[model samples]
Target: MSTDNTSLHLEKVVPEAEDFLPILGTDFVELYVGNAKQAAYYYQHAWGFQPVAYAGLETGKKDSVSYVLQQGKIRVVLTSPLEKDGEINAHINKHGDGVKFVALWVDDARKSYEETTKRGAKSYVEPYELEDENGKAVISGIHTYGETIHLFVERGEYEGPFLPGYRVYDTKAKSPDTGLKFIDHMVGNVGWNEMNKWVEFYGKVMGFAQLVSFDDKDISTDYTALMSKVMSNGNGRIKFPINEPAEGKKKSQIEEYIDFYNGAGVQHIALATDNIIETVTQLRDRGVEFLYVPETYYDDLLDRVGEIDEDLEPLKELGVLVDRDDEGYLLQIFTKPVLDRPTMFFEIIQRKGAQSFGKGNFKALFEAIEREQDLRGTLN
Candidate 1:
């Protein structure tokens, strides 16, 4: 994975500011599931994530179990409650298997909590410490859209497999590395007309700024339409694109997600990769399904995106889409829904010095999504 471009690309887009809080990067994305063990295996075998740590009945007294998976700079915690009628089980019942927390790494957890709460953010967890043999780390959290939370993690002096509670979970399973690097951006699908409210909430509560905006007019097809606005922190380490359904000839994809998800929540996560061609090839061979476009898209792709380093045949054969801006170009492709509910999915992206989102590919991408939703009977 290309880890060298993060600092350079973020510097070009964001100017230094005397903001109240400074976030380092994403610590992890936590998912609440009905079965953490099987879910962990699914990620490792399907997405090439390595098993890192685990917390369950074997570790100690427990009401829930958690499994940590890592690859490159990405870490995901899959948690499941052992008891019925608990909060974790309640969340799983309502939303199915989906993201519950988008944890952010910070330097000072207490200060970050105070700063955000003072600015009217709802508190999810007070600043607390968890100590181990290595050291101590502080953490706090605040509520976000749906039941999801944004946890502020300060690893202070602590150094262990994960937190103080988790132990190393070793396994004999082996999967080839797929070259997925880190989280590029997270997209949230809110209800109708709720996008602007959350965008303003991030601006006022977390001191983020607007990076880009897309309305229904620019990103729409004949069957469905949606509006999105991208928000980023000052250092540009984290980006969240909020989307809402716009009136169309039929139900938009955002509406379908909301109907199935039961509320506003994370729609998809875009993971950055250095070599998407190789990464996707491995993922496809390993049973990961991706959305496909008509061959006609590649016929005029070069004319639209101009010359790219990769040839047209490989990209078209693999069903990858290309887009460009003044800064540079990018190649991106989306996977089909990973869960049974058609709720959460993923995107494999390779950015070739491009600082902006792939705006040019939205029409084709949304049309593919509409096709899927139609088959699922979500679009009427």
Candidate 2:
């Protein structure tokens, strides 16, 4: 655990890069699951996401069904195959309910596709228009690290529940809103030496700039270690931190995720909140399990991160970790794997003024993750 700097904050000097494929923001994230209905219910009841739309057999889609849920600006589309065999079914069978598409809201889908494909991206879906009574929306896609895709959605004229095929879906069941404001960042885990490969892809293919990076020396525990690099788009609305396993005495979390997911894929989604204490409390009460942090970690919290606004007891009780950067501080906590395979999970974050990810908290955070891996019998 190296805490050399008195402040222990990682200062960023991100170089500005010219973005060819201009993205407005994240459109939505779609996950291929075994059961869309049950997954939607779990998200609604457990995570306080409100149902927004639906598309299925009754809506004239026979092969698959989808349910869209939203909380703040974050929209999650859960899709399941209705038939016995298809691409969606194949994805569910292989990845076990993980992120399939990370859609970006763009101004022009065709140009976005053209730019990326010309820059060496493999085309998954060509630009196509989907129109209904509402209007028209254009969508295109390109392959990324693993089975995951970056879907470009140009929905400037379309106005419906979600895309053109979905209709307003309401169950009449009240699910209170958790304070999740928007997606802070989404992290992807790659294989043993593939981090730089994808990092270069983002930089060269997508025109994203490197914000910050970490080696094993900055993010290692006694048992395990990993390396990460944060890449952000031109406007900074989108950020992706790519991670890969590093050599250590035992298997690291990145290695564990790759083993379980069977390839490189999204490891976690970090949702931002204005008040982490309140948001985490609601999540815990609603049956979301967070990683446990020992009480001793909070004894010197004030000294490590400097003064924060929230009460120390509440943060310690909730097992939320605090860290500071050159700009400011942030409060964050990691939930245990939301799935059975221990491949994907969620991170609740509240940025006070910090633009940097919690670099100061990496050691303690990875140690907590190692504890979980030990219980799962994967910490070799």
Candidate 3:
């Protein structure tokens, strides 16, 4: 874990403006699952992700099953265990369905781990080297809230398709690329009154500073309410939004997450794409189900946001939402809750140049989510 002093140093460096944030790009997202094979197939067929690598019993790995999938520059790894009672099983059982690892690219894994750990971060995995015919890869991990973790990856020293024993599958059956090129942000839900604790934890331990904050008033509906705060690393390569439930007439999304997941953990991963219409169309045709908004909502989009560069007809046809900022404009859409637990889902985002989250679409988006909540009988 990073120490308090390191947190102070980071606070001094990060600027309030978005332009000052330094983030290279996403590395890979790894999820702990109950069944890696089935999950991988669902992602490939439904979300347009292509199978890239695999590891398990066949590869002499006895404890776990891992499958790697890619679409454009985005890579996701799904991991499950061969047996029960292990850490993987424990994590799945406790968190229901959530991300286990957010791998970050770094020039040196050992140094990153040491620097962060010495500063006060909780050590999940010590820096270790793994080698095979493909060469060597160094990795280390640090614990975060619930079962989620951040892994430091130093792959410059290694030359491999993914890791040892995995051969790249060159298949022409690619899922049409959804304009998404990389991860934009990952949101997590925590328990009531725990928002500030996590904010401080991320700030103190991981060299992250609070970027934005929203209370119940900013993200509340007639039936539900929740508070949120966004945290970013020095290079903005990592963005985590922490949410907590607030008093409401009915169960807030954050409360529902706690109930289904059995605790706080990841809520959704927002992925950035270049063309949302094309990507969402491919995903829908491939079997991915997205959250639906009412057609009436689109009736006033043009007047609300003025004239956007893209034709509004295509976006409305695909159920996409648009939001603009002084910097630029962006198109976005969300998937229906993917897991049985209503724990983790995904966001498909296309940013023309804007860096802010889709604030303008919050009302329509929340209304869409409320529609789902009503269907699931989770709405109060």
Top candidate on lDDT is 2
**Better model by lDDT: candidate 1 vs candidate 3:** 1
Alpha-carbon lDDT of model 1: 0.88
Q: Could you give candidate 1's per-residue lDDT for residues 178-264 as a string of tens digits?
A: 998899999999998899999988888898888889998988998888999999888888899999999999988788889888999
Q: Give the least accurate 10-residue stretch of model 3, judged by summed lDDT.
A: 1-10
lDDT of 3 by residue, 257-312 (tens): 88988887889999887778888888888778898877887898888777788887
| Residue 238 CA displacement from its true place in model 3, Å | 2.1
lDDT of 2 by residue, 166-222 (tens): 899999885898899889899999998999999999999999999999999999988
> Each candidate's lDDT (Cα)?
0.88, 0.91, 0.78
Residue pairs in collision within model 1: none
Reference-based TM-score of each model:
0.96, 0.96, 0.90
lDDT of 3 at 228: 88
Off by over 4 Å in 2: 1-15
